[model samples]
Target: MLRHRRAACYRCLFEEPAEAPSCADAGVLGPVVGAIGGAAAGLALALVHGDRTVSGALLVFDDLRRGADPRIVRFAPRGGCPACAKAPILPSLSPSISPLAAPLRVTETS
Candidate 1:
């Protein structure tokens, strides 16, 4: 079944290296690579299955990387909200805040 193939791929890509080196050996880079690969795989799988299920699977992979509960990444906010244009900052400031909050701060000499 397709599920078996996916599991095998994940094992080969991620779990196999556990014996050789912990994921931490590569710093955060390993997980980021794994996540990008997993997302691509999930998108390909979605072409075969329903989009909803593939998206859910991608969320699961992302959550696994972050050590948190899984949830879908909504591509668009409800009602085309402008505020949603900002990136989701998981553990840091929103990317847009710097320009909006203190545009002149960098030029001010201390």
Candidate 2:
């Protein structure tokens, strides 16, 4: 896995006005959760689309309240990793349909 601490990437998404209230004051509307979720989804979509520039990556936003910068940490599975070895390979989907366009549905699974 590879990680990149790209300030540009963070700025592109979560750079708010200096005068804006801190996340603590915003409660559920904070950038902490939204930023993390968006970054994860974007990476997943890039992989699904066969983007050569992307690989297994992690974006970490540790303490936003303290004004800490986001960091990306990369790691690789050990040799002959059992989970990786057993992971199923699924057929790639054609890039015609946009996953973001679909409405989200939450259902209980047993």
Candidate 3:
């Protein structure tokens, strides 16, 4: 597996502070608001992209910092997920794991 710690470091170096996003809330209401906000955003994007499938509506926000601070935002790689160089996954008969997902191309985009 190839790691790009250097690229990530550079992304952080170029980042600037942006104003607080509109999602701020306090206490128990915070999670509820975030969830609803995510769902709404997904729905709105789905309409724009012309994809209504459940998978299409789902947005995977991988916060490497895991919500440590909202002011900091890392860059998403242009190539997206690194899928192509992965070794073949053995089919999982276990119900816990879903059957093999469609293969993803990991080739680096120029």
Residue 25 shift from truth in candidate 3, angstroms? 14
Instruction: Note each model's CA RMSD in angstroms.
Output: 15.3, 14.2, 17.2
- List the pairs of residues colliding in candidate 3: 84-106
Model 2, 10-83: lDDT tens digits are 22222231344444454545565787678678876776776635454445666644677556554444343322
Highest-scoring model, TM-score = 2
**Clashes found in each candidate (C-alpha, N, C closer than 3 A):** 0, 0, 1
How close to the true structure is residue 78 of candidate 3, measured as C-alpha lDDT?
Answer: 27
Q: State candidate 1's TM-score.
A: 0.26
Worst-scoring 10-residue span by lDDT in model 2: 6-15
- Give a tens-digit lDDT track for model 3, residues 1-110: 01132233221222322333232221335676687587667666765676533321223444575865233234433232222113322225333323322333355668
How much lDDT does each candidate structure score? 0.39, 0.44, 0.37
Residue 60 displacement in candidate 1 (angstroms): 5.0
A best-first ranking of the candidates according to their TM-score comes to 2, 1, 3
Model 2: clashing residue pairs? none
Stretches of candidate 2 exceeding 4 Å from the true structure: 1-31, 52-54, 63-69, 86-110
- What is the overall TM-score of model 3 with all chains considered together? 0.22
Write down the worst ten-residue block by lDDT for model 3. 1-10
